[model samples]
Target: MQEPQSGPDRRMFLRATAATGAALTLGGLSTQSASAVAPGGFPDYTYVRTLLTPSQLKYNPTGEIIFPTVRGVYDKLASPLGRYYLYYAPHDAPGGICLAYGNSLEGPFTEYPANPIVSNKWDSHYSVSHVSSPHVLWKEDVKEFWLYFHGENTTTRLARSKDGIHFTYDKVVLNTSMMPAGTTETSYARVFRHDLPERGASYVMLFMTNNTTDHRDIGWGWSADARTWTFAQTPLVRHSDVGAINVGGPHLLTRNGSAYVVYNKDKTSGGDIMITEVGKDFSLRKHLGVFYDSRSSAPENGRAAAPSFGTDGGVPYMIYEAGERLKGAIAVARG
Candidate 1:
């Protein structure tokens, strides 16, 4: 069955118009676009420093990590969890959900004592070869933290926590079963809160799905609550759309009233971030081209993937994996 599609909303366009109000000045250069997009339209970010490498972590059992999901601890009661929590894991066998903490966005973070808070083996609940690509969302209405991760590269699972450290495993939220026929893998998901009231979904998720042909594309779903989800019959963005061998690491960037999907594409030259503007209906509307290129950066070593955006002291920053796949460092960049 097909999902209902939303018509062009005048308010959405109006909001989009408002989003183009001002361009941001990045690195002594004006990189803003006239189009309605996030201010500065994905900044001309300057590489800052390597925030964390597997070797830096005191308790990196896997000796590798990727997909950094950083969130601020707002509630005063969560003082023990530090001001900020950075969640990441290895996309290898026995993958886990691990965390680090710090007071500042540009972190000198310390790994949690009880690292790998959630492991591949959960006994009666579920067990898989590896669990990686962690995306955590703080549910304000419920006053709880919800973590979404994938294991076996086929199933995306959910686990909730009151403390953001100790988690209670929830059921698998998405897998190949919910996708179109001939689909092989469904993983690398990121969720966001959007203003699409017409869709009847307060939250939306963007994920990477691989087909029988091994082509990777972006898949999407919607939910009123953060738990249950209903995905589109097809991908939201395709490798062919961007002329890439594969595309993953989906991130939702909403500014003013406009929404954009920023993801990494595997190009012959190297991996780089790309952006596409999506309508309020959650449909891919336009390809905005390369958001961040990594070929010139020596630290990135011709590759950058899985970007997580944040702002520190009003300056926009990105936390992403820099270097080759499975052999990279968690890097921080500011603009």
Candidate 2:
């Protein structure tokens, strides 16, 4: 792990741009005007419907467990064919990468008949142990989908898929050995492929890692080809500043030229979805504040975390895990 660099030059550039009220651009995507902040202070997200629950999933009845206990749903990615792909892990069973599908973003998703698309046996390192927090990326240049996930919450791994359903294991991308000594583990990675000439790299990853104190924070890495990575030793988003003990499960969204990282900040009751602006170089910029909270009054819906963003018919949507870990349901929200 490399120590976080104090980016004075980059900060100066961003401050200058904001002072002049100039739109930022990256990879042809224009930034929003200074006046166009998130509507209603934060995104007015309304609950749509529940997408998945442990009882609702289609799993092998004769398998080790009758109904697999879900730890949490990781993320969702959309296909050009109008299907939404969701990744999750079963707590009791093999706990590998499982796949589910639905036609609508706010859907009654069906678990793939051939689920656990990528199992623990696929990787020789952490075979049959645990693999979770899968974030998939669609590489337009190669017309293939790449999956980034963690095994045993200690190593970040990669795999590739041709049709976004079946996947082939690639290699371990990040682990404790790659970080500074005393780094306990690394996991929950969110990757983005941007076209920012100033950054000198195209691929950026925001992930979570624990230090000797077992404190989790968001770290980052950059890659030119989306394969090999160079990780930052220090955290990109710290828990102290975010007002959360554990900050993980990062998701990236880019609009106009501005980029945002939507992640969960653990709270005593549950968790809240928070958003923060990210620099073109994938550095943490400004914290935009909480976007959603699942702890309701009437029909309480425990913790809500692990957010994944998508769109249907040009309408923005979000899918997240609601309830306690290992006993949660995947829910959807629309703007």
Candidate 3:
């Protein structure tokens, strides 16, 4: 990933992409499919649904177990595994993304061993692998795997995995903080791809960014190869909504022409999960409020860490983490 830059610079990339006619488009939000989840629509899947929570993971079994600083498993890419594949920062090192496997929809999962496919700064001084949550990318043309995630030194890195178990290559794609020393929100990035599947060859690099200076708002990046990122010229979303502050965790999910962003809002004042419809090009649509909050008072089980678009019980669902200790488990929301 490229080094992080100013918010204006980032947003410019997005605007330029739109001008270049290389942006995304969406139809709109739909309850038509998510509604069929339950019998009478009694909130069949409001929040408590999960494919694989942390309680099921053993160790970093496969892929990248990358996560954000939000608490539990963070952003995950589209992987169609029966269970949810969470990415997290383990052992208090910088961060890392890993994958776990489950047998059932709601797991008691068993993760791939050898935790930490990528380690914090690779056990070095500057720290190159202090990796964060990763969203996977599957490129049919290259027949290779792309793992996009955040880094502590204030940058997002990318890695290539051939078998999904062992990685082959890696690099940073976001901005490097030019601040005095530290005092930056750190570099964060996520991954998302459109389903249109143009015959040509292309990829989308979704990012997790912050203005850091005046705390402008969460920013983004646009990349075609996942290595050289052009900070989005315009923000895909804002830092707050309806007079609130804080916005992040850009989980872009597309289904049947509509793209949904499962992100966090008001995190400072008791965070809650919210969903919004966005055009393929990142235009805001229906603001679906509160995708899922704490299921119960139970010690605050966890919070919305990362989110990914998925299918639970044949219904489209967005899976996220709920526990801070990974024991609470990951949560899912349909419709």
Candidate 4:
């Protein structure tokens, strides 16, 4: 059977456009192009991050190998320790326990301290939900680092850090879900982080959200100031054709001059990657195609956090989620 495709239907797009006119005008995201795509915005898979097939790493009962489904990663300063911090619902000796890593994108990755970094004690946000989807970025201009994560129940949490690994714990930024009242309980969430590039005149916060229904879609809330965020009130991508079942990890990527969002879609547990691009102002976007699909091993399922991208020598790579039997192991794929 063919996998279900996801996108915004014409009627839904028309309705969303009419409802958020004022917000778009005020936020400056109204530069919608009816016919022009930003100079280079197309979502296509460059390459997938793969595992080294190290002897130290072995497969579990499912007989499928494991890897790091690095939901989020960022190089804060230059390189080395500050080079990359991979976060997920981490998988290791225990699995779905905490954040872990690989020194680089390809690994032989291990857990951090062999335990959960932040746990249920973080229950302040949502008593039942756990922390997932971490987006980390450093801002040299303000001399501060920011960690953006979402709890299972709450929309998202924003924290600042003087150093990359540790945070101030000062206060939760954007302490509320952007979901509409009637849809709050049935929704997935809104995950956002401002990926500020020092040279770029504008900043982009790649995010995912669901206004109503089961995982309606994922998108970003764009902002120039980084203080006031304008929810695309519309998702950057939609799974309208994906049968209202599953879609996750809509991490943003840019190539040349365009923007692309990557995600996984599975009616089952172990899922695969999906890519799509946005129009100049997100007024128009298209599902380029599926990069990877299907279960490699067994007991296949949907996916986990996001994937991290980097280059080895000169080849591009990615780290994502893979599951077999009882393990939702982080796995990699390459061109």
Leading candidate by lDDT: 1
> What lDDT tens digits, residue by residue, belong to model 3 across residues 1-335?
23123222333443454456553332443222311122112232445455444334565333222233221122232443423444444423445566664543344445557766766555332365355666666655566667766656466667786545567556666654522232355344566555323322134555445555434234555555556655545556666553437666666656456666666664443455566776565555566655545443432343554565555466555565555433444555554
CA shift at 270, candidate 4, in angstroms?
A: 4.3
Candidate 1 lDDT by residue in tens digits, 251-277: 998755678888999876568888888
Candidate ranking (lDDT, best to worst)? 1, 2, 3, 4
- The superposed Cα distance between candidate 1 and the true structure at residue 259, in angstroms, equals 0.7
Question: Among these predicted structures, which one has the highest TM-score?
Answer: 1
Model 2 global lDDT (CA atoms, 0 to 1): 0.67
TM-score of each: 0.86, 0.78, 0.66, 0.64
Poorly placed runs, candidate 4 (over 4 Å):
1-83, 90-97, 122-129, 170-177, 185-201, 225-227, 241-244, 268-270, 298-305, 324-326
Q: Cα deviation of 227 in candidate 2 (Å)?
A: 0.5
TM-score for candidate 4, please give it: 0.64
Residue-level lDDT for 253 in candidate 4: 65
Q: Give me the overall lDDT of model 1.
A: 0.80
lDDT of 4 by residue, 1-335 (tens): 22123322322343355455422222345553232111134322222333422223332212222323342234444443423455554222222223455565555566455444444344354342345555555555686756565554345556666645555543344433554443342112223333434323245565545445656466566555454555545555666744435565666666655666667665544456667766444555777655444333432244433455556455456665555322454555442
What is the TM-score ranking, best to worst? 1, 2, 3, 4
TM-score: model 2 vs. ground truth: 0.78
Show where candidate 3 strays beyond 4 Å.
Answer: 1-44, 48-86, 123-129, 176-183, 195-201, 213-216, 284-288, 299-302, 323-329, 332-335
Q: Which residue segments of model 1 deviate by more than 4 Å?
A: 1-40
Give lDDT per model, in order.
0.80, 0.67, 0.50, 0.47
